[model samples]
Target chain A: MNLIISTLRKDDLYNKKIIENIQKNISNVEIIYTEDMNIKGCIGCNRCWLVTPGICTIKDDYEKLLIKFLQSKQVVFITDLKLGFVSYKLKNIFDRILPLLTMNLRFKNGQMRHYFRYKKHYKMGLIYKGNGNREFLEKWLERVMINLDGTSIGTYNIENEEEILNALINC
Target chain B: MHLLIVSCTPRAKEKSNTDKILDELRKGYEYNGNTTETLYLYKRNEWESIREKFYENDNILFALPLYVECIPGIMAEFLETLKPKQNCNTKIGFLLQSGFAEASQLRCCESYLETLPSLLGCEYNGTLLKGNMFAVSFLGSKMGKQMVEPFYNMGKYYAQNNYFNKEVVNDFAKPEYFSKKEIFLSNVVSPLNKLFMKVFAKKLGCKGSLNDKPYQNYIKR
Candidate 1:
């Protein structure tokens, strides 16, 4: 399954474009439009890692999305550039996904990382607009994927719709 | 000038590691005759007031826990509300701590934190990166308090100078990577630690298995 999350507005043309392209070119896609959802940011509660284990205590709209994420083999974060990084909407989703990982520390690739709670090999991709401070962001994305034990498929500027489709299709 | 210490930890005040670090720093800052106000961002209703205080102060320090290899999601949202100020003399620095022992786990986030002050039109005060925060459960223990006691000295240095002491920052972010021998030991201990987490969760009265896969069947792999 390919899970594509967009922080774009429900009425935005780019949001529709990305989903339409994914639907046409990809199979078994789960599309999440952030503006249409009401999810709060993670409060740094340790309940997900301790009490419930692989479940967040916040009890918001994110649980349905989290379940979808576990089933996904690939995820593409569709967002706008904000302060040289992904938008807060996309960032909130990333933070809330902490339940997917355990609190235990392990060394992988010479870095300390949380062990996976579930056994799944997932890949991540990014689609964003603008080029403000992209060098750091690209590196950051690679680092985030490394923590997930996944490889980043890379980023696509808004104009490179074909490149994105090709990457997903080939992924 | 007064300092405004902002805590980006979304955990409750009693359970926050960042809050404890800030307490030590504030003690040093106040002892040096510099007054300070510490703000916690977890109080969603107080953001409007927090933003006002942030704008009013010139020396600001954001102390945050490293989550998901970056700033916490709530911190990101709060940052989004801040607009770039022009001709502002506010200087910003960071106290970035991680539970992980290696500096490599925090390098990317540190890079991002370094770029933050400049992007907001504030002077870039250097970030103090440290690892080995370990766990919140142990932070309340006597041994844990001893571990963070050294940050008091950092607070004293900040009171005299606006930024973190460079020598201390270097020392704190130690063992950036590991020796080849340590890597071998890490490989040996990784599985053991995984088992430890399961045991710890059970002791905490966890209602379900630590490795339960409640949503695994959503897609056929």
Candidate 2:
């Protein structure tokens, strides 16, 4: 099983501790870091849908990361709570996923829905490190999960590392 | 009288916060004796043609939803390409809508707020900060309808009286940089943002060009 962790915090001990715990629990996981990947803002261009079906036309890290998204068995995102929402860095990635906003998706329940279709179902997890609005974050997480046709096993606040780790490893 | 409204929502039919505010503004000011024309940027086929339209209009109002903590990328580009002609007498005003209920997003339009009057040589009217009022859950409810009046009044005040005079503008506090958390996010994410957005031209599909990549990356992250 492969896992990917992306976060907007670097060199912070608190965040580092959480990352280390995640790494320890899930061995052989490849991390695609935010600092190294350098994702850009989505310019609201629909080229991903009109020109290139099911793929983002932007040639930068999105293309590379899209491949990572395809290969990974589980996708985990860690975000700092800024005003009760994901940081703008994470928001940019979410915005760029605009290309994936198509309705041609195939759901596992033998029904078709409108979403960026991936070939299979993958487990999704969110680690919100800071104390932001849990309610809002949960709604957003649910929305994004539904779009990808993936199951959202759980969301954890970094303060409860032990509890969250237990949930993640078990799920 | 003709009023030109420039809307910056990416989806043409989608009801973004900006769109919702604009719709309300449009309805409130509809029978005030002017023919209003709306130019949705996402639907505009040509970039330069819109700039040409800007020069042609006398009263121009800009409406955009705040992204991250700033203006959308296309709005910045639109402002940059504007060449205010000698005959251009556009009276400019702004309406900003954002999900976060803070004045921080005002920074996104800092340059436009400062330069619109200087370049266009027109009066800078006041701006309405429609904060957290566009949620679908709030629509058609009395709370939603009543809250819109104050914002409309603010717009009417500015439209009727020039509000961005040097003294008036200066009275407001100078813009602040990102909070400590924002700084951490920007530093970590700006590099990848640059590589993913600029170098690869992944943003080519968008309407306008956001040339100030580095600064924008910092603000965005």
Instruction: Work out the TM-score per prediction.
Output: 0.92, 0.49
Where does model 2 exceed 4 Å of error? A101-116, B1-27, B30-221
Candidate by candidate, in order, the iRMS in Å equals 1.9, 16.6
Tens digits of lDDT, candidate 1, B1-221: 58898999888888887777777778877885789888889888999999998888889999999887788878888988998878989999899888888776788888888888888889888888778876644545676677777788888878787787667787767888888899788788878876777787788788787766666676444
TM-score of candidate 1 on Cα atoms, chains taken together? 0.92
lDDT of 2 at B217: 19
- CAPRI level of candidate 2: incorrect
Task: Write model 2 residue lDDT over B16-114, tens digit each, in one string.
Answer: 556655666666555466567788776647667777777787777788775434455455445545565675556777776654333443544443354
Clashing pairs in 1: none
Q: Put down candidate 2 lDDT per residue, A1-171, tens digits, no spaces.
A: 455556655776767887788788877677767877767666544456434445565677776665555566677777775434556566666666544444122222322234444345757777776755565556556645665666776677877889777876777
How big an interface RMSD has model 2?
Answer: 16.6
Fnat scores for every prediction: 0.71, 0.01
